[model samples]
Target chain A: MRIELAYFAWVRERMGTPGETVELPPAIADVAALLGWLAARDERGAATFADPHRIRAAIDGALAGPDAPLAGVREVALFPPVTGG
Target chain B: MIRVFVQAAPIDVGAEIDLHDAGGHGASASFIGRVRGDAGLTELFLEHHPAMTEAGLASLAHAAADRWKLGALTLIHRVGSMTPGETIVLVLASSRHRAEALAACEYLIDRLKTDVMLWKRESFADGRIAWVEEREDDRDRAARWE
Candidate 1:
């Protein structure tokens, strides 16, 4: 399935890009699997997803977890914990 | 109803709240975040991807409306270059009672800081740019609401 991926703050800095649209392999079943797939794609992806504990994910616009299903999601955002006020 | 505005100009939080409440609000609360010159920094520059920023703010407004009994809500966040003492963001909530308005205003600010997708870069006097990290206290504050 095709999905839109967005990066924010330091995550965008490390990734060197803000957002992208990509097609996922069938094996990429959930958020965690998608992260692993992305990491395997290149060194930058690996580095970005290196510390999942510090990273936050949002499926569509709502906060989500790594194990959350991405079956119908059109977008997934990955970024450091939010800090804005 | 909730209104969200993100601009590069100065934000007058008090005036905005007053205007919002002029219609017939009994209670109103607001939060104004300013650039702290004491961050060992000379100036601050904020950048955001336009579409994403709007989407993020819209989502935050929706959350606040769903969580509180609000009569009017407004959030204004500035971007681009800003000096010390300048406002960064403003959150205003109007309700029938002070408790609900206060809680909603706090909730809006807290969630905006912790969940929104805006980015700020601090430039030190020595010529360095750094991304602000998520504060531990912000996380704790957000947790209390959950």
Candidate 2:
């Protein structure tokens, strides 16, 4: 599946881009798996996903856990924990 | 009534308060968050998801209204570059009595810290830039509502 991936804050800085559209392998079925695949893809991904525990994800604009399925998700946002207000 | 706005322009607090007062509720409560100038901070930049940020704020406003029998509620958050002392966020809650409005105001601000899809980056006078880390206390405070 092809998905739009968004990076925010430090994640964006590390990834060197704000967002991108990428094709996913069949094995990348969840947020955790997606992170693992990206980490192995290159140095930028490696640095960004080095500490996946600190990262948070939103699948199709709704907060989702690592185990959340990405079967039909069109967009996924990855960022550090929010610090607003 | 509920109003949620996310903008890059400066927040007009007085104007917002005037509008909330027009609602004619017997009691009103508000929370205004300003960018702190601590440690020689120069600027505070807010990063957010274009669609998700507004949706998150609206959800928080709706949750506050449902939890408390509020007559009116307004939530505003500023994005983009901001200097110290500028208002970053504003929350206004009104109800027939004090307790409901006060609790709703507090609840909205508390939940915003952990729930909103907004991130703050700090720029120092010494040319240092860093993203603000989420505080454990913020998570603890949000958990209090649960």
Cα lDDT listed for each candidate? 0.81, 0.93
Residue A57 accuracy (lDDT) in model 2:
98
The candidate that wins on DockQ is 2
In candidate 1, what are the lDDT values of residues B4-96, reduced to their tens digit? 887888887667866665257688787889999995787787766556676788887877777776888888889888999999988888877
Model 1: colliding residue pairs: A84-B113
Deviation from native of the Cα of residue B50 in model 1, angstroms: 4.1
**Native-referenced TM-scores of chain A, all candidate models:** 0.92, 0.97
Judged by DockQ cut-offs, the docking class of candidate 1 is: medium
Model 2's alpha-carbon lDDT is 0.93
Q: Best candidate, lDDT-wise?
A: 2
Please, what are the lDDT tens digits per residue for candidate 2 over residues B6-123? 9999999999887765266789888999999999999999998899999999998998889888889989999999999999999999998999999998899899999999999999
